[model samples]
Target: MKHQKELYKEAMTVLKATSRTFFIPITFLEKELKTTVGTAYLCMRAIDEIEDDEKLPNTIKAELLHATSQLLLKPFDRNAYLKLLEPYRHQLPEVTLRLSDWLALCPEGIRNTVASSTSEMADGMAKWASKGWHIQTKEDLDEYTYYVAGLVGTMLSDIWLWGAGIKTDRELAIGYGRGLQAVNILRNQSEDKERGVQFIPDGWTRNDLFQYAEENLAKADQYNKSISKRSILMFCKIPLALAHKTLDTMRKGNNKMTRKEVEQTVEEITSE
Candidate 1:
C-alpha cells in the first residue's frame, strides 16, 4: 500500500490537472479540509469523466459509474477496483484513473461522505444516461443539476460543519450548487449541444437560463454570508465571485472570463 503522504500527493496532482478553476480557491481551505475536499472533488470528477465521455456506449458508461460508486463504498481494494476500471482506463482522462490514490488517503468521516455523494451521483448519471441525456422540462433540468452539482453543495456544507464547526443552510447550499451548474450549462451550451446533451428546457430562451442561474447565484451569495469563519468564507467567496463574473460574461454572449479578469476577480475576493 502506498503511504498516505504519497497518496495525498497523487490526489493533489489529479486535482490540479483536472480542475484549474477550483485549484486556487481550494488552497485557501485549512489543511485537513483541503485534503478531504480535494479527495471528494477528484472522486466526483472521475465519475464526471465517465458520464461525459462521448465515445463510450451509454450502457458501458452507466456500468462504469455504478462500479465506481460501489468501490468508493468499500474499503480500498486496489486489485478489484483497478480490474473493474481497467477496460475503460484508456477512454477516461488519465487524472480520473487515480481514484485509488484519492480513496486511500481520505479520512474516515470524509470518506463516507464522499462515498455516499458519489454513489448518489453515479446512480443519477446512470439513470440520465439511460434516458439518452435528453433533459426536456424545467423539472428535468433541476433534477439533473441536483444530481451533478447540488449534491456537491450539500457535501461541501457537510464538510464545513464537520471540519470547521460551521453550520450552513442546506437549502442555500443546494441553491449555490445549482447556481454554479447553471452557469456551466449556459457557458457550455454550444459544446453540450454538439455532444447531444441539451440541458435547456423546451421553449426556454437563453434569457430564461440566465434568469435561472442568477436566482441560484443570489442564494449562493446568501450561502457565503452564512459562513462564520473567515477562511471558509474566503474559500467559498472566490468561486462564487468567479461564477458571477462568468455569468455576466456569458450574458454578454462571451462564454468565458479572460485570464486577466479571472486574476482580478480572485484578487478582489481573496483581499476582502
Candidate 2:
C-alpha cells in the first residue's frame, strides 16, 4: 500500500501535468484540502478521458462511463474496476486507469462525497456520449453544462464547507462552474467541431455563446466576492480571472490567451 504522502505527491504530479489553470491554485491549498481537491479532480478527469477518447465507439464510451459510475456508487473495488477496463487499457489514459488510486487518495471522512460527485459526472457524461452529444436546444446546452461543470461547482462548494466551514450560494457556485465551462466550450469550439461535437445550440451564433458565458460569469463574480477567506478567495480568483481574460481574448478574434497573457493575468490577480 502506498503511503498517504506518496499518494498526495503522485496526485499533485498528475494535476500539474493535466491542468494549466488549476494546478497552481490547487497547490496553494493547505495540505489536507489540497489532497481532497486533487483527488476529486483526478477522479473526474479519469472518466472525462473516457468521454473524450476519439477512438472509442460512442457505445463503448457510454458503457465505460456508466460502469465507472456504478463502480463508484459502490465501495471501491480495485479488481472489479480493473477487470472492467482491462480490454480498453490501450485506449485509456493513465488518469483513467488509476481512478482507484485517486479515489483512495481522498481523506476517509469526505471520500464518499467526492465519489458520489464523480459518479454523477460519469453518469452524465455517459448520457451525452450515448446520444452522440447532440446538443440542439438551449435546454440541452444547459443540461449538458450542468452535468459537466455546474456539478463541479457544487461539489467544490461542499468540499469547502466541509473542510473549512466555508459557505457559498449554491446557485452562484453552479454559475461559477458553468461560466468556466462556457469559456472552454468557446475556446474549444473548433476542436470540438473537428471531433464532430457541437456544444452550441442550433441557430446560435458565437455571440449567443458569448452572452451565455457572460451571464454565468456575472454570477461567478458574485460567487468570488462572497468568498472571505484569502486562501480560498485566491484559489477562486485565479480561474475566474483566467476565464474572463480568455473570453475577452476570444472576443478580440484571438484563439485564446498566450501563456504570457495567462501569466500576466494570474500575476495581476495575485498581486491585488
Output the number of the lDDT-best candidate: 2
Please report, as a residue range, the 10-residue window in candidate 1 with the lowest summed lDDT: 95-104
For residues 244-271, what per-residue lDDT tens digits would candidate 2 score against the true structure?
9899999899988999988888889889
Q: For candidate 1, give the lDDT.
A: 0.86
Which residue pairs clash in candidate 2?
Answer: none
Every model's TM-score? 0.96, 0.98
Candidate 1 global TM-score: 0.96
